[model samples]
Target: MKTARAMRGAAARRSGRRGEVLAALWLMAKGYRILGFRLRTPQAEIDLLAIRGRTLAVVEVKRRTDLLTALETVSLDQRERLRRAAAAVAAQRPALAGASVRLDLMALAPGRLPMHIPDAWKGA
Candidate 1:
């Protein structure tokens, strides 16, 4: 039973990573320059960071069996963490600090279309 549970958890993580890759590709197709994937900071981690024109976009990718589930995954605290992580990245790249920074959420569900929500959160 423990082995089964571990396998399931591993599979879920793998699926989530795959969804993130798909989300990254979708953003690239939209002319966004991909900066990093699964970027880790001391404070938090950002799933995807991209640049479009002069705008810096911090993206969170959530994958679930359905759209509703995916949307629910991005909680307030999670959004805040993304925002902070974006700031950390900006500190390293000073040019990004001067540009417009935006927070975005991308939802990917099996057998469904990908949904991109720009400015998904506000002051959280």
Candidate 2:
């Protein structure tokens, strides 16, 4: 049998994957094409990479009890890491090379639609 901590970890991973799927569907509804999911580079892991028009969005999905808490889960350091990872991914793809890139947040809670915060973090 799995230990309590292992069970919790599994549940958390399941929830995170669900949130990412929801976020991707939400982005698709907004006309953004999902370029990748769980893009992992040496610098960081981006939940979702999407493009719409001339914009490239590095999306972070959060599942929490509240919007503020969900939004707060992404730290500044994480944002910078995601930005750097995104840059690397963009460099590898001709389509994303010159698009404006930004960090976005998709906050999810029970029974509520995903809240998309565009350009949520303006990395310096």
Candidate 3:
């Protein structure tokens, strides 16, 4: 049997994954093509990678009670890690090479649509 904390953590992970899917769909509806999800590099795991034209978006999905809280979950250090991961991915992926990358946050709150904040964290 799993402990209560572990159960909660599992549930949270599920919710986060769901949010990510929702965010990707939302981005698609807004005309962005999702290139990857939960991409792992040595530095960090990017929740989503999207492209529109020559721009690449490194997305972070957060599920919280409200948009503000969800956005707040992406900390500065986390942003830096994401930036590093994006750079690494761009270096390895030919499609993303030389693409302009920006960090974005998709904030998911209950009973509401996901909010896509582009350039959410500027350069970590």
Candidate 4:
């Protein structure tokens, strides 16, 4: 039998994956093409990478009780990490070389449609 902590960890991972899938579908509905999911680079792990027109979106998915809480959860350090990860990924793919990067957030709450906030933060 799994320990309590292990069970919680597994549940969290499941929730995260669900949130990411919802976020990807939401992005696609908005005309963005998903480039990757849970992409791990040397800089950080990106939840989702998408492109629409000339913009490349580095999306972070949050499953929370409230949108405000989800939005507040991304710290400055996390934002910087996402930016760095985006840079690393972009460099690796010629298709993304000239695209502009936008840090985005997809907030998911129970019974509510996914809330996508484009340009969610300006990285420092």
> What tens digits encode model 1's per-residue C-alpha lDDT throughout 26-123?
99999999999999997678889999998899988987676667667788777777778788889898778687778888988768888888777765
- Candidate 2: tens digits of C-alpha lDDT, residues 52-93: 999999999988889889777888888889989988989999
The candidate that wins on lDDT is: 4
**Model 4: lowest-lDDT 10 consecutive positions:** 115-124
lDDT of 3: 0.88
lDDT of 3 by residue, 1-124 (tens): 9999999999988988888899999999999999999999888899999999989999988887877786778788888888899998898888777899899988887788789999987654
Cα RMSD for predicted model 1: 2.0
> TM-scores of all models?
0.88, 0.95, 0.92, 0.96
Displacement of the residue 85 alpha carbon in candidate 4, Å: 0.7
TM-score (C-alpha) between model 1 and the true structure:
0.88
Clashes of each: 0, 0, 0, 0
Choose the strongest candidate by TM-score. 4
lDDT of 4 by residue, 81-101 (tens): 889999989998998879999
Ranking by lDDT: 4, 2, 3, 1
